[model samples]
Target: MTLFKVLSYGKGFKGQAIWASVCSIVNKLFDIAPEILIGIAIDVVINQEDSFVANLGVVDPKEQLYLLGFLTFLIWAGESIFQYLYMKNWRELAQKIQHRFRVDCYGHIQQMDMRFFEDQSTGRLTSILNDDVNQLERFLNIGANDILQVVTSVVAVGAVFFLISTKLALLAFSPIPVIILGAFYFQRKAEPRYAEVREKAGQIASAINTNIAGVATIKSFTKERHEKKRISAISDEYVMANESAIKISSAFTPVIRMAILTGFLATFIVGGLDTLNGDLAVGAYGVLVFLTQRLLWPFRDLANTMDLYERGMASARRILGLLDEPIHIKDHAQAENIDLSGNIEMEDVTFKYESQTSAALKQINLTIKAGETHAFVGQTGSGKSTVIKLLMRYYHAQQGQVKMDGVLIENINIVSLRSQIGLVSQATFLFNASIFDNIQYGNEQATEAEVLKAAKLAEAHEFIVKLDQGYQTTVGESGVKLSGGQIQRIALARALLKNPPILILDEATSAVDNETEAAIQRSLKKIADGRTIILIAHRLSTVVHADQIHVLENGEFIESGSHETLLKNQGRYHQLWSIQTGGV
Candidate 1:
């Protein structure tokens, strides 16, 4: 059933599949023709002038032999030609399907909601896209053709058997039912075992990925042996799962071999007797003997083909299952891109993460006017960043409307909505690329001069030009070669390059030194004139000059006003400032 589902999913390749299958069947037909020709050759030798070929008017025995040789050459050439055709078509079809599935699956994942990623591991996804897709590709390349050819061999050979002698044919084919039943039994038993094998494989992949990503932590804690043991445990489970599947598949070969031997022996002994008694022709008997081996020998490969089939189906289940995952945050049917002017408002907004019992933001009402600077100061986990997330539509608020320039956020296209906001978060991420490329990522079409201007404004150009390659220097994975302060500056430069109407600095200066922080602040002052700036920070000094400072506690705005007014009230803001500034 899963195979059928995969086939249907690949219905787009129906024409290719059909052509490949036809070639496979024709190839097998040609492949078995030599044995039939050898039988006729024997008839030409024994009957001489009265041979079957002679009856067709080629009375000379030597001429019949010559004719057989020529025909043999043609049959071999046809077989070789079809073999090449089938292999080419099957492999090409497999490659196209494999490519399409991976690209489409990745595209689907890119559109998934953030919460979907929270529930999945990077290693598991990697395994499905790489290992699992390759598994299916392996089946298409070889196993699918094997299955089709085997059936063609049976039908074509069986017709020849019955045409020569029905009684002998019936005896030769008697063992087939047993082989079929055994194959079905193997499939039923192997399905769950192979599924377990694939599951264990994913677990091991996840374990290795986690260990590699956290190798720094493991080394710092001196937990090398512990991590090795952890990975070894996962590897052992994978082997055990494979061994369980192998047991059933291995037993299949010997059982089917015995059944095939029965068929071979039946044709050899019975057909030989009929020939000796003159009831069957010697050439006909030769044909039966050779064709019996040809038909039954291939069933020996049945176990291996079925193994591939079950494994591929299991992988297909995972691949299709991922594709079936609903996109929970896609744009509405009527969603359209709209020009925005950066004014943002959240009215009675409340939100709770699915994993948490308590609300992250509660009864929040906020107004951010265009071309003004506003700051939110709160302790960790006090919902300061949650507001920024909601504004960016990363997660929707469950109980209120987030409006941008008088339009409900959900009504605007998500790409258009996020494109207008430049976010520089505390946890900055940089791709492994040149500094110029990383900074230019925020605006793909930005010219070199524009990038330099933004970098200078973010106070990053002075440090960058001192490096060996300047803007051309490669930042290792996640910008590992750069210091935290430098990485933050590059991230800031990227956001600045966008020149968005709304700029959000979510603790963007947290990692820099005091002098660097002051430089960033001065740059921000220049850029903040005509853009809506939202600041979330723990350093109360950063908000001292804001047009409005709102202090949050337990997801509620506890104090709101200018920095001077909040300090005058001697509330939460005042306490935080006193602690940071060493004041009473």
Candidate 2:
């Protein structure tokens, strides 16, 4: 699978490839013409009247010499022109393919399910998209060009050598089989080594990305030295992997050179003997000598070219594999847009994560009527978040149906389905942009006035306006410049701006202070009217006013009632409520 199959991608660029190859071959032919000219000039000098040029009717020595000079200029000029054309063609193709492929690969990735991201690392994905694609670019830029020229040189030179002296040509080509076998041997061994190198590179990138993102946590825990050691260990593995590939690939040139030396020496000795015996013309022998070196010297470049090829192929395998990965959450063929009325239902739903052995949600039936607020309370790992994920179609249920209004969510167009739901999660993520931009992220076309209105509804406008630049203040990476309350409120503003019929807030206020939580609660009450709100909160007080409350245990709903009824029943919800309120 790692072996480069150029036919896979090369088919599309057949025209460019054909022209590039033609340019390489024709340029090489013109380049070799000068060597032939040198031999004929020698013929003209030694046997002016009987020279090969005399047959062409340039009998004078001076005239023949001048003709060769003129021919040299023309041939060199042609060589330069074609060299420029081939390099430009090949390099332009590489750049265009790289840009187009990156965009296409990213588009495919955007359609994959949430589980795909859970199984992949940010650093590893970044490495593949940026590093791996760039590796292919490097190879395509010049490695392919080198390979084409090498092949053209061999075919063109071999014919000339055969014409001058067949016996000597056979001796010169004797080591070719050995050289071919050696190259194959090197490729076979280098492939796995390079694969390991690429894997280790991803690991290193993942480790670095983790460290950078968690630098604050590292300093908080005083684990700076420990993190450095951990990163260094991963980096050492990368170095070791590269070293293994290098050891095998670096030996290729020296061994090929030795084989090339053998053939070169044989040709020199045999061709010289033929000339001394007058069996071969001296000028013809000169052409063979020059052609032999031109043919073999480039084999050294072959080693570097193969190295690039193997590395690029290894990266390509990973990239292509990702592009071919199955999309599990795509809309069904019969899917259609639904005019959502905010009513939601989960009927006998059961679901399990692909990596988990047990079901995350059992046979649970639930409903939230349009404009009604419902809350789910449970301890950690009680599948609160999984419920939200299912309703959004971030995952699919293994059994039963999840419906929006009267239509099955599975039969709804995925984009339309998601567009009907607005979500504000516990961990709020904001882009590095102005506060106005972050608030308007969910609705890019929302006017600045609408953004400000949503911000005020989320109780974020007060603090935003207090800042020096007000709405235009930039929130650094992940909104790091903003406090937890500010981040959550801004996220709420974004969700509200979308103004979907269904809103799900999962532990949205858990991390904020009591004062901020109270402010958010007021905003929530204001926005909760005329919309279906599904609340998943660890903070018991936040759900006190919810229309209905359900206590979830394991993967099933153990209790369901209004807040007053749950407390009166003295069940699981009562137990949690008592602990938080200390029985008031």
Clashing pairs in 2: none
Worst 10 residues of 2 by lDDT: 1-10
lDDT of 2 by residue, 423-468 (tens): 9999889998999988888899999889989999999999999999
TM-scores of the models, in the given order? 0.96, 0.97
- CA lDDT scores, all candidates in order: 0.90, 0.88
Off by over 4 Å in 1: none
Expressed as tens digits, the lDDT of each residue in 152-254 for candidate 1 is 9999999999899999889888888999999899889999998888888888888888888788899999999999998898899899989989999999999
